[model samples]
Structure formats: C-alpha cells, structure tokens
Target: MQMMSVSALNEKIKSLLEATFLHIRVEGEVASVTYHSSGHLYFSVKDDRSTLRCVMWRSNVSRMRFRLEKGEHIVIDGSIGVYTPRGEYQLIAVQIEPYGRGALALAFEQLKKKLEAKGYFDATRKKPLPPYPRRIALVTAAGGAALQDMLKVARRRWPLVELLVLDVRVQGEGAAEEIARGIAYADTLGADLIVTGRGGGSVEDLWAFNEEAVADAIYAAQTPVVSAVGHEVDTLISDFVADLRAPTPSAAIEMILPDANELLRTIDELGEQMGRRVAQILHQKEERLRREAEAIRGASVLRRLVTLEESFARIGRDLREVIRYRLSQFEGRISPLERQMTESVDLRLRRSGEELRSLSEALRRNDPTLRSKEGWAEVLSEGRRRALESIKVGERFELSDGRVKVRAQCLEKRPLK
Candidate 1:
C-alpha cells in the first residue's frame, strides 16, 4: 500500500464514488434540515440504523416544488459525490419527492395538520350563512367559468341582489396574497354575503386557496364567507375556515339567493287560501241570518204568545170580581147579627141586679144584731170558778156581763132546812 496525503486520499475517494455510484436513487426519511442564508439546504437522510449527508443548492432548490420537513419520508433522485475537504460522501439531489402521492399531498397534509393543531379547522368556529343577501361579492379570477356560472345563477335566482365583483388571481404565484386581500377588502364593503372560488383544476392550480394566509383572512372576516373551490371533491383549507362550503360556484349562488318565481307562487297560493276562508266565513254568517229570519216570520210563535197573555188577563179579572162579591155578602149579614146580640145582653143584666138586692134585704132583717139590746148575756164565772170548800166565806166572786162586770161576796152559810 502506498501512503498519501489526506487531500489525495479524499480525491481518490471522490473519483471512486462518482464512477461507481453515479445517478443513484435512495429512499429514506429526512432527519435534519437546514436552509442557509446563502440559499442552500443542508440535511441528513436516514433509515433505521444509518444516515447519509445531503446538500441541495439554491439554484436547484428554487426549482423544487416542495420544501423539506423533518421526518418526512421521501425518495431522492441524484448522484453520489465526495467532499475532499471533509473526506466524506454525500448525495447531491437534483430532484426530491414524497414517497407516496408525491410532494403535493405531503404539503397539503402538513398544512392541514398544522392548522388543525391550532384549532383552525374546528367546526365550532364556522358561522352561519345569511338567509338573505341584498348584495353579494364574488372574489374569483377574471373571465373564469366559475365567475360566469355564479353570475348566471344569481341573476336567475334573485335579480334584485346586487353582484359585486372583485377579480383576483385564483392560482399561481402571488395568487394567495391577492385572494387574501380580496377577502379582507370584500368584508369591508358591507356585502350581505361573500362567495369566492374558481373552477376545478389540478392540486397545483388550486393551491392558492389552501394557503395559510387565505384561510386566516377568511376566518377573520366579519361578514360570512362561502368557499367554492374546484369540484365537489376538491377540499381546501379555505373551505374549512369559511362560514360555508359549496360544491360549485353556482351552488354557492343558489345557497345565497331565493327563487323569485317560487316566492311569487307561494304568495299567490296564500292569497287564494285567504279568499276561500273569507268566503266560507261569509256563507256561514249568511246561513245563520237566514235561519233567524225564518224563525221570526213564522206565525205559530206569535199566536202562542198572544194566547198566554189573554189567559193571564182573564185570571186577573175573575179574581177581582170574586173578592168584591164576598165583601158585600159579609157586610149585609154582620149588621143584623150585631144589633140582636146587644139587645139580649142588656135585658139579662137588668134582671140579675134586681134579684141580688131583694135577697140581700131579707138576709139583713133576720140578723141577730137587731135584738142585742134585749138579749143581754152575762157570765158568772168566765175564766175560773172556786168551790166553797176552797174559799173563805168572805171571798168575793165576779159576775161578768158582755158590756159590764159586777163583783159580789157571800157573808153567811145556810143549811138546807
């Protein structure tokens, strides 16, 4: 083996790598990425157990369709080269792609995940579309099919609604800025509703609506926004952030505008219903009035009422005549009976008075008081008597008259012989 300087050895290794592994293709995940101020990208590509250094020059990076992010699985198309200064080999990638549906899908998924983590895709953040829009703003590319379709549908649906057009770049470079500015400006214009979209195209052609700036502008708007980007299948970030999503630009117009013809038909139908109701009510009232008139015209009801009134008058006259006759008969009979009773009572009182006087005089003539002067009565002893055996000869005894009293004394005793 011949010994040589490190630079010589590096040069030999560089030649070997270029000659042997030129135009190589490798598949792995991005490990670390550094975008330099010099407009160069330095990164490492890795598998489970090994890593390879890689560099993409600014010139090539400018041509790339997508930016590299850490942990993204990708396939690199380039050649192997050795750096003599570092004595290490690295991949000089000309083109890089996502492992699957390529960088477009990767970029979309990345943005979606980022916005979702920030709660930008939450359903609660969405607002309700206005039921009626007096004025509508259309933010779309100039002369596109989407703008024309919207205009046509709006005119047919509700011609009264004023259409305000703010044409902008729908896709390509600077399209996102233009679309964002249009949304903000339209929000300031006091339009009742806003509809912004473009016709269907490839993901690259529709990428402007998916940009973060457009989504943020739509979210910040005070007026409601309806996003109709591409076909029904094409969903973008703006669609999620806007107040409403329509499958097509024409569909958005349909949502915001009411059909004038249909409204007129409804109004006419209502007027007819009202007329029928009013007619029915008048018919019912007229039928009721006719029934009442027929009842009043009938003669039987009037005849019954007259008969009852005559009966009540006849009863009143008969009651007055009966009371007057009974009073006259009581007056004639009571006058004679009262005079006879007074004469009989006077005769009976005179006879009873004479009989009482005669009886009383007879009784007085037979009374004992007439002879009291001749029939004087005396009592010898009124209260007590004393026997001779108990009295001395000189003892006095009293003889009492009813009017006067005399006292006497016994002086001698006499024998019976």
Candidate 2:
C-alpha cells in the first residue's frame, strides 16, 4: 500500500515473521522429509488443516539424535525465516525432538526395529562366547570408569588373559562411528573375544550404543562380542546385536573369564583327591600283597609245597629208573651189533693186509731200480739223461749202477750198428 519495491516488501514480511516467531516451538506430524547430500534436512510439518515447510541446516541436523521421518510427530524449536529469492517463509529448525519421547529413546526404538527386521537380533546368528578367552579386545574409553572396572575385574578373575585396550569415544556426538570403527579394528587383532561398553550414565550419554552403526558393527564382528553398556536396567541396540550381553562392564569381564581363585581351589581339591586315590591304590596293593603272603605262610600252603617237592622227587626217581632201564635195553640190543661190527672190521683189516702184501710183491717185480741191480745204469749229461750219441764231445757225463757212480768226459762219438 506504501509503494514498496518487490525486494523491500518481501524483506519487510521476512523481518516481521522472524521477529514474531523467534525462539518458538511447533509440534506436528512430519512429511516430505528429505535428507540432502549436503547434510541439510528439508521436510514439512502438517496438521489436519494447515501445513508448514521446515528446514534444518547441516550443522543443526548433524547434532540431531534421531532422523526426521514422514508422518512422525516431532517438536521443532526454531524461528520462522524467509528465503528472500522465493519470498517463501519456512521454519528453520535449530533443535528437534520427538513429540512425546526423548529423541534418544525414539532413535533407539527406531534402530531396534530396523535392525531387528534385518535379523541383527536373531539368537541363531549370535556367536557363542569363548569359555576361556586367551586374549580380549576391550573396546571402551581408555581412562573411563568402565575400563578401570573391567580391568579390575579381569585382574581379579583371570590374570592370564591378555587385554588389549582399544580406546574409543563411548558417548557424545560422533561416538557411534568411533565405536563402530573400534569394533572393526578389534576384529583384526586376533582377540578371542571383544567386550565393548561404558560406565552407566543418562540415556543421552549411552546413546552411542543405541546407534545403528554400533549395532551393525556388533552384528558384523567375527569375534564374539559382549555388550556391557550402562547398568543392569539399561539396554541398547548393541546388546541385542552382540553375541552376548552383560549388565555392566565389570560383569562382562566376569562373564567371560574363569575365576582364578576358584580354579586354584578346584586344583587343590583335585590334587588332594589324586593323592588320596594314589594312597588308596597303594594301600589296596599292599593289602593284596599281605593277603598273598599270609596265604603262602599258611600250613596248608606249606604242606602243598612239600607235597609238590616230594612228588617231583618221586618223578625224578621214576625218570632215572626209566633212563637206566632204557640204557640197559639199548646195551642188550647193541651187543650183537658190536660183535658183528668187530668181526667185520677184523676181516676187512686182514683182507687189506693180504692185498697190501700182494701189491708190494708186484711193485717189486716191476721196479725199474731192479734193472740197476742186474747191472744196468742210467747215464746223465748236464743233469739230464741223454743218449751217448747226443752228448757233445769234451762234455762231462755221469753213470750210476746200483750203488756205484762213474764220471767220464766224452772224447769221441761212437755209433752202434
């Protein structure tokens, strides 16, 4: 009405709306929600008769505990603002919360529903915790009470286990991502088990455990994971997805580790029982030996032994008699055989002597030395017997007749006609 330019008129409306609606709150059912890649949230709040457009910039949206989903009742705390280019007024949300519930609680229920549908909480898929873990990857805040409690319990229960403290933020903004990354890294550490948790706190303080990222990490762990968030009454999505759930950090340590003192007591009992059993066995053996010795000392046993010896002596006498009788029978049977053998041996010796004498006579008759006894001799030249004609003239020769020898020089050759 006052001849204002288009930009100035729009600016005036924006100024009025922003001033009047500053630090206001509105509750409605959400619709047309869009989570932009730029991290801004674009959505609408609608009622039966009216609708309002809303936007939460990335900075504020990043701080929100839960997502803005369509048809959800939400309360946004912000003021009206104008997009001057479009001259559109919208609610710029600075803070948002679920209409009737805490944002973290709502987020917890939402994530629980989503992951449950995805089978994150199925008992069949849960890994069985180790009875005695050799190494444990403790995923928690480094200096928090949770870590101290777990360590104390572990030391008291099982000092043998190797605890690898994987420090991570257990609460506050971005804590869920840190926890998830910690779990993933712990899986690579060859730990027999993983225990992740923090000390008790408010729902917001423990909200990281309720995050979907933490739940997914727990669900995907190869190592058996034990969720021990907050106190006994508090539960998180991690508890549902983990292989096991403990009421508290200290309880997780106790749940997974054997009690060293109890084990020592058991060992002592076993050792005593073993010693008693050994003593009992030795006593049994000694009693058996004593009974056997008593039996041996009995008069009846001595009598049996003596009777056995007498029987053995009688058997020996009978055996000797049988041996003597067998020898006599063998001697009787061998007498004729001995006589015939002696007679045959004497006849053979006599025949052999007669043949020997006959052979001697024949050898004497055919003896070449006998010719020498009848006046024949062998002539030799140069140590060999040769014809007189073969002897070279002037060569020396020898002749022997029986017991006589003659040496002569061959001076002439002579031939017999």
Candidate 3:
C-alpha cells in the first residue's frame, strides 16, 4: 500500500472532484441554514432519503433572487468541491433557486405576474366567443387523447362547424417552437377560433406551454385562442395569455359550440309566442271595429234624415222613382186584406140585425100586456055572468073591464037550485 500524509490525500481528492464536477445542477430542499458575518451562505440540502452540504460565497449570493431558509426547496447550479482540512465533499453553489420548480417555472411565474400587471388577463379585454363558430383550428398532437376528446365533443355538440387540425409535438425538445409556428399558421388560415392543449402529464412534459415563445404566439394570434393543458389542477403560461382557459380539452369544445337541438326548441317557443301575440292583437282590433259599427248604427237615425233631405235635393227624380216602386209593392200586398176586412164587417152587421128581429117577435108573443090588448069585452061578460049567479035580490056589486068600472044592483033573483 502506498502511504501518504492526510493533507496530501485531501489535496488530491479536492483537485479530482473540482475537475470532474466543474459545473452541475442539483435539486433538493434546504434542511438547515447559516449566514456568516462575511456574507456567505451555508446550508444542507436533502431529499426524502439523503442530504448534501452546499455553500454560496458573498460574490455568488449577491446574484441570487431569493434568500435561503430551512425547509425551502431549491435548485443549485454549482461545482462539487472537497474541503481539504475537513476531508469532506460539498457543492460550491454558483446560483440557487426555488427547487420544486425549475428556472422555466420561475420564468413562467414572472411573466404571468408581469402580464397581470399589464391587464392581459382582464375580463374586459377578452374577446367574446363566437355564438356559432363555423371554422375551428386545433393545435395539438396528431394522436392524443386531448385531440380525440375535443373532436368527440365538437362532433357531438355541433357537427356543421369545420374543424381544421394542425398536428404539433407537445413535449420534448423543439416543442415550443413548433407550437408557436402552429398557432401563427392556424391564425393565418382565417379560423374563427383556435384550440391548443394536451392531456394531463408531469410539469416537465407540459413545459412547452410554459415557454415564452408559446405565450407570445398566443397573444399575437388574431383569432381567439383557447388554452387547455393537462387536467383541472394544472396551469401554464398559455392559459393566461390565451383569450380563454378551459379546464380540459373537451371543455374547450363545450364552451365554443352550442347544441343544435336546444336552439331549435327555442325557435319553436318564440314562434308560438309570436303567434299568440298576433292573435290577441287581431281580437282586440275586431272588438274595436264592432264598437265603431254600433256607434255608426246609433247615429244612423239622425244622419239618415239629413242624408235623405240632402240626397232628395240632389237626385230626387231617381230616388222618387225607387220609392214609388217600393210603395206600389206595399199597396199591392195590403189591397186584398183591406177588401176582405170590409166585406166581413158588412156581412156581420146583416146577421146581427136578423137575430135582433127574431128575438123581438118571440118576446112579444109571450108578453102579458099583449094579451090585455086582445078580447076585452068577452072577458067582462064572462065575469058579470059569474057574479049574477052568486048575487042576492037586493045586493049591490062593482063590475068593470080593465079600462071602465060600473056600479049596479041586482034587479031579479032566480034560484035554479
């Protein structure tokens, strides 16, 4: 075994580590922190299972955007180094950033905040979605769930709308460039709307949407663009830059396309309401017309006399002929009825006179006064003969007819018994 002093060995290790890891990147959370009077930062970085010590000199610390604290997740760009005195390996951090997110994430957030300050996300600036989009451009991968889901939704909701799809890679290198070009191309085609999105994935997988190139592309697009990346929980730069942000790819279609059946039903209901309104108006007009007619009829009595007087002066010859014709027809109808009534009255008077004469003859034949007028002398003789038989020789009696009475004495008495 080759024997060497500990100082010599430590120096050899330091030279080898510095050369081998001259530049590198590390991601972890800060477990502990220390700030020195000389403006140096010292902290331990750890993951779920292991830890590493990191240091930033005052020269590099001035370049950092954030201060290091215990339990803060961060990424360190540095070289691996060995401390000869302690014989330990450590990271000499050139740059330090919040770890869970990469430099791209930080950039994304910075741009978002900047755009927010500029009012890019203001509701007023957003273009209204076309109520009936006739042409649509889809910027997404050729064979992906996002494209398929959106297609299904578009077809189901509104099949008449034309969908123009531009295939583009959504992940890996050169993806952001392709996406930006696709957006520009789709817009140049005069599409009514543009939709760009992908299915859910890791943050790295969705990094293309976070790129500034994509955000600028969306902002520059003349046509309205809908951003739908990953699932509901995922958010990216394109979401803010675009005119609208949908929770998912399919939801973008749902927002832009209206259901045809629902529109038809609404049209039918409006038609029925219009018909009812027209009918009601017509009925009201009819009632008003009837009232006007009645008013005209009531005025006819006074108006007709004045009208006849005026018209008689203007066309009296013509109207007089028509009136004469009507009066002659009325006379023809009344003549027979008048003659019949006159004849009936005369015959009734004649029959009444005959009945009066017969009744008078019957009353006289039974009258006692009529009998007194007949056989006056014969009655007086009969009564005198009866009295003489009953009279004694010296008796006196009164004998008379109805008109004359005489007083006499019995001169002889004859008893024939």
* lDDT of the candidates, in the order given: 0.86, 0.91, 0.85
lDDT (C-alpha) at residue 14 in model 3: 90
Each candidate's number of clashing pairs is 0, 0, 1
lDDT of 2 at 388: 65
Backbone clashes counted, model 1: 0
Give the poorly placed runs of model 2, Cα more than 4 Å off.
1-8, 84-86, 272-417
Q: What is the lDDT of residue 300 in candidate 2?
A: 82
Give one digit per residue, the lDDT tens place, for model 1 in 1-417: 899999988898899889988888999999999999999989999999999999989988876657798998999998998878888889998889999767777777778888889887788877777777799889998789999999888889888999899999998988999999999999999998888999999999999998888988998889989999999999998888888999888888887789999989999999999999999999999999999999888658878999999999999999999999999999999989999999888888888888889888887655445433566433244457545444457767664434556687768766556
Instruction: Spell out the clash pairs found in candidate 1.
Output: none
Task: List runs of model 3 lying over 4 Å from the truth.
Answer: 1-78, 81-105, 117-119, 301-417
TM-score of each: 0.64, 0.64, 0.54
lDDT of 3: 0.85
Residue-level lDDT of model 3, residues 197-297, one tens digit each, is 99999988998898778988888888999998999999998898889999899988998899888888999999999999999999999999999999888
Q: What would you estimate as the lDDT of candidate 2?
A: 0.91
Candidate order, lDDT descending: 2, 1, 3
Clashing pairs in 3: 74-99
Pairs clashing in candidate 2? none
